[model samples]
Target chain A: MLSAYNITKNYQTNGRVVPVLKEVSVNISEGEFVSIVGRSGSGKTTLLNVLSTLVRPDSGELKYRDDNLALFPEKRLNRLRQSDFAVIFQFHHLLPYLSVLENTLLPFMSSLRPVSKQRVQQARAGLERVGLADKADRLPGNLSGGEQQRVAIARALVKSSRVLFADEPTGSLDKETGKQIMGLLMELHQEGLTVVMVTHEPGYASLAERTIAIEDGTIVH
Target chain B: MNLFTIPLRNIRRRPSKTLLLLLVFSLGVMSIVALYQVSLVVGYSLEKKLTTFGANIVISPATEKLSVSYGGFHLGDMVFDVQELPEGKTSQAIRSIKLQDRIAAVAPKLVSMTKIGDTSIALVGVHWPEERGIKSYWAAANGRFPEKPDEILVGSQAASKLGMQVGDVVSIYGKNFSVSGILFKTGSDDDSVILVELGVLQTLLNRPDATSFIEVAALCAGCPIEDIVDQISMKLPNTEVKALQNVINQRMASVHFVQKLALSVSLVILVTAAAMIGLSMLSAVNERKKDIGILRSLGYGKSQVFMIFCLEAGFIGALAGFIGYVGGFGASFKALEYLALSEGAVPVFAVAHLLLASAVFALITIVAAVYPAWKGASVDPTTALVAL
Candidate 1:
């Protein structure tokens, strides 16, 4: 389970302070699929970033299993990021130089030791689940937009992290490919994966078990 | 996949950038290596040539007493009655010393005054073969050196004063000698003396196997002239073996100057090379900002990112060092040939030197990349969200 109490975030632009998240709070239970919906500049993405530990909130107490993650040291935060959390960005930021399988195994590549054969097999299995088994050797640049996004998904699930944070995972995909990606997420959620996704699409928000709407940096019912 | 794989892949994917960096760094290393090697060889060559300009050590009978004088008041010359050294025994003793290998030449001389047509002139006897070794710059102004005991060489001053020619037969101490050569004007005492075979002069003077002193030209390249003199003195305890300190100092000074000049230039080149590497790494960091951000978001530690760039720089430096050393060695030979000093110079292939240069360049490049690598590590993980 994850909890946020009175979270507030601000961004500085052109020497002016702008409130992005204004003392908003939300909670999600384990194995639950939650979606945050808002218009552009409504602080939906900012809330997702703050919750995922990508960006620290200016004022908040973010707790996971009775531990305040906001107070964790950088090294400890990195450890949790590697083992307990996985993020899927909208752009599918795969390293252009690496192949699809290498991108899927990107999480383990940063380690000092060589990636184990068993871990490599797990990455391959992840790629297969994303329907990219035959395209493992192809670079990200050589793949279609949808296929690239699928590689991103494969990379995320390769670690088998406890929590999945999808930030507009289908923002750049075609409707049909978005449907397929959403269907994949639905399947994974049914298998008891905790999912916190941010999207502006009402249809996708409707597919989630719970939704939190934001307007002008404040949560509105 | 290991930590190094990312950098390796990036370098391979970016061939032009890598090659450009390689070329710049290789050129810098090549210049340094070439200068270093040339300085070593040139220093050796200069020392050898300078040592041969004249003898650096002189051995003479220690019993010779000095005349006493007070200012301009004349005092009679004092004599110890021992006029000369036993040439054969003394030469053998010098050759048997511990540092004899450093001895390039040993020319024995016996000086005596003799009348030539009522004008008394200084006559000097010398071992021609040994004298020629130390007097490598000596050339025939008119004819060749004396090859026979009956032949003699007349100095320019002696020839001008006596009006002698190369083929003229001159009588010295009532013995006939053919003038084999009119010697070049050396601007030394040699220009004012008549030189004859030591044996012939010894027989004529009725002092068999006698020499006034021995002039020794030692190869002073990396050799201690004082040590050679001391060793010779130990062998010939009754003789005074003195090293010409001024000549050794001047020779060493010239060698050191050349080496210092080369080292200074090498240092400048090293610094410029390091700066160039630092700038290139900075540019690489800028280009790989997205990669750094993504790696950070994937849970790569800041130090890990720093090490990736450092490893990339070290790889470039190591390759450049190797290429530069080989190129520089070949260039050194060419430089030596250009300076016309290739002959009589020994070529050395030091493996340890090569490895040290490579390791040093690698370390230098790694140090140069420190700032850029730190910048790469400081890239925020949130950049992954916005940079795309």
Candidate 2:
């Protein structure tokens, strides 16, 4: 479980301060599928970043299992990201030089734990779960947009992280492909995996167990 | 699936960039090796040529002159009794010098005047073997050098004055000697003298085991000639040691000038190569900003990212060093040929030097990549992934 309280973040550009997140607050329960909905420039992604420890809030307290993540050292934060959390981007930011299987195994490669045959097998199974088992040896450049997104999903799930954060996971896909990706997320949520996703589509937001709305860097509903 | 695989994959993905870096690094290493080899060969050849210029140090018995005058009438200066260096002790004294290895040749001469058919000519007795080392440029014009005690060599002018030819018999102080060889005109005192075996001339002059002076040829490059003279003087107090400073200074200056020029050129090449590698790596880091952010988000630490870049540069540097060593040796051979020098005692392919060059190149490349690696590691993951 993760919780954020009165989180504020600002951006400085050309001697001006722009408030992206203004005292925003939210709580995510274990095994719950939560979707954050907002229009452009609504600070939805900023909120996700702050909660995930990717960006430090100017003023707020973030807690994970009653531990102050905001006060955690960089090394501990990296360890937490490797072992307990994984992130998926809308563009499927897989390394272009690596094959699909190698991309999926990247998390395990960076983790403190030594890689083994069992972890490799699990990564293959994760690829199969995302319907990318047949494309494991192909490079990301060779895969379709939807297939690349699926590879990203397999990579996030390969480490068996306790929490998954996806930022517009299907934003770059076609309608049918987007639906397939949403369906995959729905199935994973049903299997008791916690997921926090940010999206602008009402249809995708409706699939989550809970939906939170934000306007002007503050939670409205 | 390992940490090292990432750098390998990245290098393979960008072949042109890697190749460019390798070429630059190898060029630097090649220049260093080639210049080093050429400098050694040039110094060696210069020393050999200078040795042929004759002895740079002269040793002779210390003598004192006394002026004698008869009441208002000026008389010529008279040489009084003075210490003479023992012939047998000259070689032993030369060998006792600190830098004895630098002593190239020691020619001891016994000079005396003798009559040959009512004509007085200077007879110079010499150790032929040692004299040959000092006068390496001397060549016989008519016949070969003397081998027996009764054979002798006549200078060109002396031979003409005495109407002597090769194989002509000449009597000096009632001793019959054959003219075995006639030396070419040297335009020096050598043209007016006759050369003979030391023992034969010593017995003819009735002054056994006596020598007038010793000519010493010592290699002075990278060493002090004065130090050798002092050491010789210390060992032979009864003798005077004089150094030919002009010859030594000229030869040493040329050798040092060549070495310094080569070193300066090598340093410039090395610096330029390092800069090229650094700029290339920095550009690479700039282009991979997003990839670095993604790696960080996937749980890679800053130090891990830094190490990845360093390892990539190290790999390229190692490959370049190997190719550069071979290229450098070929270039050195060509340079020696251009200088018209035959290879000396210096080995052509020294494994230790090669390994040292490789290791130094690798270190330079790694050092050059440090700034770029730090920049890559310092990239903010959130900002880099924000557009996604």
| Candidate of highest TM-score | 1
**lDDT for every model?**
0.87, 0.85
Where is the poorest 10-residue window by lDDT in model 2 chain B?
Answer: B339-348
Name the top DockQ candidate: 1
TM-score (all chains, Cα) for each model: 0.81, 0.77
Task: Report how far residue B18 has shifted in candidate 2, in Å.
Answer: 2.6
Off by over 4 Å in 1: B31-51, B56-126, B137-144, B152-245, B252-274, B331-341, B344-354
Error of 1 at A72 (Å): 2.7
Residue by residue across A1-221, what tens digits does model 2's lDDT show?
89998999998879899999999889999999999999999999888888777788999999999899989988788888887888888888999998899899987776334578988899899999998889899989999999998898888788888888988988999999999999988888888889999999999999999999999998999
lDDT per residue as tens, model 1, B250-337: 8889989998999999999989989999999999888888787677777778888999999999989988898888888888888888
- DockQ, all candidates in order: 0.57, 0.39
lDDT of 2 at B121: 92
